[model samples]
Target: MIETIYFAGGCFWGVEGYFQRIPGVVKTEVGYANGETENPTYEEVCYRNTGHSEAVKVDYDEDKILLIELLNKYYQIIDPYSLNKQGNDIGTQYRTGIYTSNDTQMKIAKNFLNKKQQKTDRKIQIEVKPIKNFCRAEEYHQNYLEKNPNGYCHINLNEANQYSKSHLTPIQYEVTQNNGTELPNTGKYNDFDNPGLYVDIVSGEPLFLSTDKFQSNCGWPAFSKPVEKLNEKIDTSAGMIRTEVRSRKADSHLGHVFNDGPGGSTRYCINSAALKFIPYDQLEKEGYGKYKKILASNF
Candidate 1:
């Protein structure tokens, strides 16, 4: 299905750059969203008084890039706890927000916000509103990073590049590094015979197993739960639509989490780029200490 997300996090340029580099984002355009005017201009938005926030509009494939994953990335670069400020950039236009296009986006946005609130001890000031009109930014704003690798922007490539240093294969680099996505049902794991835990592709963190996977018919891998700590703060972001899931450790693209799953379930549909699986028989041989206990308990 076609999905859009609008995220605002101070200085649309940097936020745009960050999202443009992620996988599953079909298109990335810097724009002005959630405002009163019919079509607010860049200069008008600069005043930070048109009720507009400098935001990024992201066109993504839901099957490839989950909303939860995008939101998490939005939080990584900007401080959610702070109000209308990201590092040096500060203004009403720089404020955080999630502008929805329809009832489904609205519902998912609210549910995500609620989950975020419960996890954080601080109060949330993120604005979740219906999108009014989205005006695309000047042509120079599009692919700012690609045009000039060392251009002036808020995001630090060193921080992002650190995650890219995981020795990913050529295809992994093309997708994760270039913001491209693997076609649905074309990944190696989709039809693998190996059955066991899937570790983090970059960090090798034990995340999911074949047994825990359930067919969501969503053309992606879905798991009931994550192997990591549940309270991890997945950030909320506003863009072409609003997205909510991003990983900080590897900075690699991860899938989204949702309350809706098959068989009355909660599914965390993840990207294969973010994981590496360990077959059940190879668990002990791979020096996994005692993961045999996980297999033993099942029987």
Candidate 2:
């Protein structure tokens, strides 16, 4: 199913371009939203005090991406605490806001804002309200960055690709960065089950524990659960629908989770290329000695 949401994060060019690269985003358009007048032009919004904020209308597939995930991504691009300004653009049109279409969305947006407010002492200036009106921008404004490669974009489009390219192997990069799956039954840890902690290859954050590992014969290292809370997103790629898991810190794609497992437990079919195992004995040397006691009790 497709759902629509509006985001006003400074200039719409960078916001639209950044979301376009994300998976599950069906379409994006630049427009002026929650304005007073109908069919307001870009010039009117900037100079005529039309009360319209330059926004991006995003239509995303709910089965593939959640609204919260989009909101998280939105937070990364704009300063929620800044009022009527972002980057170098200082104007009402560049003000940040989240316009929702329904009560459910409004609730979610408010809750998200409340949680964010607790994290920082700075007062958030972002407006969270129901979308009152929207007017499509001019032809040149649509996909502006895509059309002009060197166009002025306040957002860093390559922020998602922040990982060091030289550090990861070809398969690791393909799996973690590009969301490519390793060949089944060919991973280094598929058949070799040793006592250790499986960590995200990119972030080195603890993911799955050895105690949770089980033989599922699914051509991947299967675990019943993760040691840490990993991010889960709906994945509708490859002609099949599944829940894709990623490391929370690095946001690197680890693998997919399934309901089929031993004794009614869920299975975390992870990619070995996306993980780095830290042996139990070397846990102290690796600065993960805190988990040594946990691993011992499980063994």
Candidate 3:
């Protein structure tokens, strides 16, 4: 079935760009929704306070694009916690929102929010409202990127695989490109219970060892810290969030950093997508002999 979802997250220009490139999204259009005006102009929405949010309408096949996945990708593009602005665009027109057509979408959006709430203690200001009205944006706004590639956009894809500096397997590319997390409790070293090394999936650079790993029960791989100096940290204060863990070298979204570690120390509960584990036995074979010291001593 053809599925439709309305996403409003700051300006709709960059947000529309992201969905357009996604594999399953059939079409995307910049528009206005949930507003109290008729055929509001850009200037009207911007300065006149027509109450219309700059929104994007996404059309996709259900078999191709899952609503939940789209929502997640949407979160990646916009600041979910930001109240009334995205990037330099300020005012209510740029608020983060999701306008659904039915109960199924309502449930999906709510469940996704719930998952975020469970993962982090942040207050979610992303609105989940019913589809009131959708007005197509002007002709100049449609397919803005294809027509104008150099147009300004605040959203960026900081690729982790870019730091690999080498070609990787398709699976590695999937993990790195899609920000895919590994399947927890199913990896080869998930329960090895021995000194091991976690390497960058694309670059094979040694990152963490078993000594640095802690059980966070996050269902993916969990690490208390990096081995040392392998990953650079990111200051996510721009979005009003405190801090996030991103690979400095590869620019991969490893995961979030939290103060709620098993102990008092911070936990870098990373996604398996950001790592490849090499046990002690395969350390030398994997060219990670430098990390063998982790096996000799426990930190």
Candidate 4:
């Protein structure tokens, strides 16, 4: 399913460009959102005090990315505590805000902000509210960064690439980023089924539980289900059709899911190179103590 969210982080040029690189983002358009005037132009928003904020309307596939993951990425590009400013831009049009149309989106945004507030002493200046109005910016403003490679952008577009290179080995990067499969029967978790959690190697987000694992004899780690939502898409590569599974937050290509499994359950065949095992004993030490109850219930 496709969902929409409006993000007013700073100059729409950088905000729109950054989200375009995300895996599940289908499309983005620069616009003025939640403004007082009707169809306010970029110049009016900037100089005429139209009460409009330069925002990007992002259309994303929920099956390929979660809303919370998008929010997490939004937080990375802008300073939530800064009021009416982001990077070098200072104006009401450049203020930080999250405008949503539905109750679910509002709740998620509020919860995310609340949790973020608990982590710091400063008050979060980001506005979270229902979208009042939106007017698309001029044609030239759209895809500004793509058109002008040397355009001024406050966001660091290379952070994702840098993170992948610094945190993952060559094989891990290959499997996760390029969808290259590991050799069958050669993965570290192929025959290992200790009590623990399997997390995405890139983002460390909890994925599969050890209790859900079973011996599928498929020469890879197999699980009945993941602990959280996973992004899935139709993969028609190598002359075969399959359902590809990916980590929602990091958008890493984990592996695939198949219908054939024990007790009519679906089998999530995952690449060990895409995951990092956190043993049950080390859950607390690894800051995954909140999941202890989930692991205990299975026992």
Instruction: Name the regions of candidate 3 deviating beyond 4 angstroms.
Output: 157-299
Q: Estimate the lDDT of model 4.
A: 0.88
Candidate 4 residue 136 Cα shift, in angstroms, is: 0.5
How close is every model to the real structure, measured as TM-score? 0.55, 0.57, 0.54, 0.58
Give one digit per residue, the lDDT tens place, for model 3 in 97-200: 99998999999999998899788777888998998767899989886754566787777733212323234555456656655546666554455456678866
**Number of backbone collisions per candidate:** 26, 0, 3, 0
Ranking by lDDT: 4, 2, 3, 1
Candidate 2 lDDT, 1-299, residue by residue in tens: 67899999999988987777565565789999988999998889999999999999988868657899889888888999899999889999999999998999999999999999999899999999898779889999997875677799999876645423456789998999899999999999998778989887765668988999999999999999999777888999999999999875456899999999987779999999998898999887665678888999988
Q: Largest lDDT belongs to which candidate? A: 4
Residue ranges of candidate 1 with Cα displaced over 4 Å:
157-299
Q: Give the Cα-based TM-score of candidate 4 against the true structure.
A: 0.58
lDDT of 4 at 251: 68
Model 3, 79: alpha-carbon shift in Å?
1.6
All models: lDDT? 0.68, 0.86, 0.71, 0.88
lDDT of 1 by residue, 8-46 (tens): 878877777766655456567888887788677778888
The runs of at least 3 residues in candidate 2 whose Cα sits more than 4 Å from the true structure, single-residue gaps closed, are 162-172, 175-299
lDDT of 2: 0.86
Model 3, residue 62: distance off in Å is 0.8
